[model samples]
Target: MILGWRKRRIARHAGKKNPPGNQEMELVIPNHFRCPISLELMKDPVTLSSGITYDRESIETWLEAGNFTCPVTNSMLRSFDQIPNHTLRKMIQDWCVEKQNYGVERIPTPRTPVTPIEVSEILFDVSASSLDVDQYRCLELVQKIQKWGAESERNRRCIVANGAAAVLAAAFDAFSNDSVERNVAVLEEILSALNWMFPFDVEAQKSLGSRASLGCMIWFLSSKDLSPKQDSIVALKELLACDQKLVEKLSDFEGVNEMLVEFVKKQICPTITKASIMVIFYMVSVAYSSSEKIKLAFVKMGLVSLLLEILVDSEKSICERALGVLCGLCSCKEGREEAQSNALTVPVMVKKILRVSDLATEYSISTISELCKYGRRDEGKILVEALQVGAFQKLLLVIQVGCGDKTKEKATELLKLLNPYRAGLECIESVDFKNLKRSF
Candidate 1:
């Protein structure tokens, strides 16, 4: 996706000639004349299934990004058949000709979109038995076709119709143990193509869930090699998200938790970190209730501390997932104890309340609620520690500014419970602090 953006950016710059010189130089293209997707003058204009029209390349890029609806109308695109707006194309061309002295370039006609027969032939070659040595070429063709599908939902459905996903999965299984570095690179491309398909074609992931394929995933993640690691994370996240049963089966694999922990702690790529956090959250959240050791296994691997580190600078998504894992861990006796025991746990948790997002707010409030409500081992110390972190201030504000009914209720209850300890706090101007003031 990033590469596509980079290509488009270069094309845009390459398309533009130098700015128009001072002919009252409002050198800007008029808004009505612009491509909605690219904001450039329309070239080879084409109308989508919706009534709106855009430059051919711009609209195709949107579709390739896996967008299903018309970017303008949000209408579900009925087909990838982007009909050429011949009238608009001529008008754009005429305008460019009129502005030739102003440095405008003539728009060229776009090539036709890839046909189904072409995609079919590629799929047939992949499925054919003629040459095992030519697997790399076949994989490259699949990647291009998947990318073409990204151009529009119509093209994507075409690729799927031609069995692009099944072929990619088969390729992964075929190359699972090929120790040749070149083969590993091919597997990475195949994995990435699968990642792009995940949002649309989930059944394709079943091929990747096999023991042999999973073993390769772990090997890539654990190995020091950096290039394929991000794709590995994306593939793993999709696989885990699609199959809850897979979550249960993961306990049999060794070092999976530890490997994901290293990814988060290393803070390699934001996407990598986010993906790793989600897989960890799914594993612990889905599996820990049935097994005692799974939740504690996270604690043993320094999961609590690692999550705290992620919370320090990570974005809202990462924050939400980290809190989720903490929630699962805190459900247990040791899990709760480990969270409160961490120095940053209470301070950061309290600070997060209304800060990142509403979801983050929910998990933040829930975490503190666990500490205050279930701080059974050291209830007094837990409440005091929370109070010291300005939990009383934040909770009162939660009630004042308000949140979802569930979150507000939890906050109100915690505030009422801690009311006896509130005295110098300024935000608690309400009656909730009356009892706590007397105690102080």
Candidate 2:
């Protein structure tokens, strides 16, 4: 009976008929349309500028809507400008093909944009004078705004977004060098608001969540005297769960993806879908402490492939961020050997290092210096070479004219790392260093 049921299920799959493992999957088209360029599928179907026969209704629609490119070839298609007749004919002949064996035809459907929610008007009532309120008090004020944001009235709810941002700024103000509990409390409150806000109005929901999440991160990571405790862990778990749901609903948003990546690196949550983010985050945090447990966890999570992917991505911003995190992870106590064994560190530097922008270049250099302070001599030497005299000269130029005092301090430290004796002599020459040494 079970075998009969299974066979029936397989048989019912429209036009999907092949023997066992070799079964051909049916291509379901919203309309009976196929791209002439890539004959197999009509995904994101679009048309070209050529007055050609290859265009489908879906392609024509996409072209009219101003997305004039073929999905398969990524070739430029229809524009406000006219397509030449020769180009149109060639595309039509090449892209229009029919597969007789395939049994499903798909119909194209218009995509509906998710409606935004009305935020509470009370949120906007906050004055610049109120920006200095206590964290919990600020949170409470925002809570009422969030409550009113859920109202059916559109204008009433629009206020919640501004309230959310105000509350975020206040939360940052409230965070101190020794306030883990307060930080967790702020995040918890924001997460609660986010959970309620996202389902109805995605824009307001995203706006509120983005500011809160970023603020929470700054407070949590920058705290010199606070670390995660049990309650903090629970709060992080809740936030992760909420973010996971949001990611599922809105995978198209890059901000969501970036924040998800940032959180996974900072907080080690043991969920499955965020496993990729977790591994990358873990590797990056390793520079602070080479905890074997974290290293082992990364191994178990299978991060080797993902790290390699980040190393190879063409985006300079992404590459820099990934490399910063990976370099930190690679310098952990047992991380150097593990990184070498798995071959995660070298190939990444080779492909990505030179391509990074000036600011990122400085960060990468500084990170390598920090790594060298703990990593094997050979690895350290490689980092030192990258910060050679000429590189240091360029870095100095950036510090003198382009960067602020903070960047200058980092540049000074990197110079120290490159040549400690000279750095020490220079430090002795400075009144600030003399005072700093005296204080110590």
Candidate 3:
């Protein structure tokens, strides 16, 4: 009994020495041995089973931050389910009243720094461990962070930025091997922190670096390797829906849009590893976007023509990717086909395929020959005329080198139909039949 009285007395008198607004006031604690939620003597002084509790505002500073365990039970609490213990709440309120009557003034403390070290320390705490934060505590951390803003000591802003990256990396690592809905929460937090860090420091959003970070996160979230539980799907969809804030940020970030345009227009190729597909998809379909700059960037980079030309590349994967993008464009609301036509899309594709057929592997020769055979029908005679001028001879040369029986059979059939002999005789005096026979 005496010990409790002495503790209260100490708390009360300690408040006096600090005085209001004194620098020393920052360290003072309220004079109470009570829980904020339950008004009574905190029996176990434990955090509730649900991971949150309401306490009298007076005893708020007394609780250890990010700790959710009931001081009494010591049982692990899940964050989302925490409910306030009102009885303990009332007791603390009563104590505050008594302290007020006794002329004890409360000294309010500013929030602690949110530096890397602080974030690291907090992560090991129980509350974050349980993945829960009550409203008041969240507000407190925000206030604290805001108070410490820009001018914060100990290089706090950078700490928060790096700390956020660490947390995001941890979340990604956790889900790297297994797909889980929990990944969404962690991803969202990472994105939020990235946003926070950007305004706080420009380096936080490195043009290439942030793109890579987000690219990785998006890849993991949409990874086909993972189970892709329903929740994960929903979460990914939500993220893709639209980010007004990100759009605004991009508008102000100077080079972000241009960087994105460059990546989309010139960087992606089908030869890229499988793990990178989702990122490519997201960048094309979501991130790089449909803005005029992006559209013009593609045009400026000659992507439209290059993409069509690449469709006939000897590399199957590269051809497939280019084809896929073309197919996707055909299905869009944009007059992609119209643009292609106006921009010499058909002529370019036909010309490239014809040329590829002349020098490509037999497999490529067969595919391009078949495409050319059927393509000129829909694409027109101009394309076929382009192919007849000894181009078929070059194609036969390639076919002879690598063509399997089936490929040779197809090439023969195409040759019968294309008959470059007459055109070859008329155009070039000497026929390169030696090389052509070698291909055959």
Highest lDDT scorer: 1
Q: lDDT tens digits, residues 245-295, model 2?
A: 332223322343343444444434433223334334433443333345545
Predicted candidate 1 versus true structure: per-residue lDDT over 45-118, tens digit per residue: 88877879898778877988899998888889899778988888888788777766555678776556667798
Better of 1 and 3 by TM-score: 1
Q: Put the candidates in TM-score order, highest first.
A: 1, 2, 3
- Return the number of clashes found in candidate 3: 26
Query: Where does model 2 exceed 4 Å of error?
Result: 1-292, 299-305, 340-359, 379-440
RMSD of each: 8.3, 18.1, 22.8
Please list all clashing residue pairs in model 1, or write none if there are none: 63-150, 64-150, 64-151, 419-436, 420-436
The estimated TM-scores of all candidates read 0.73, 0.32, 0.29
Q: Residue 213 in candidate 2 has what lDDT?
A: 41
lDDT of each: 0.73, 0.42, 0.40
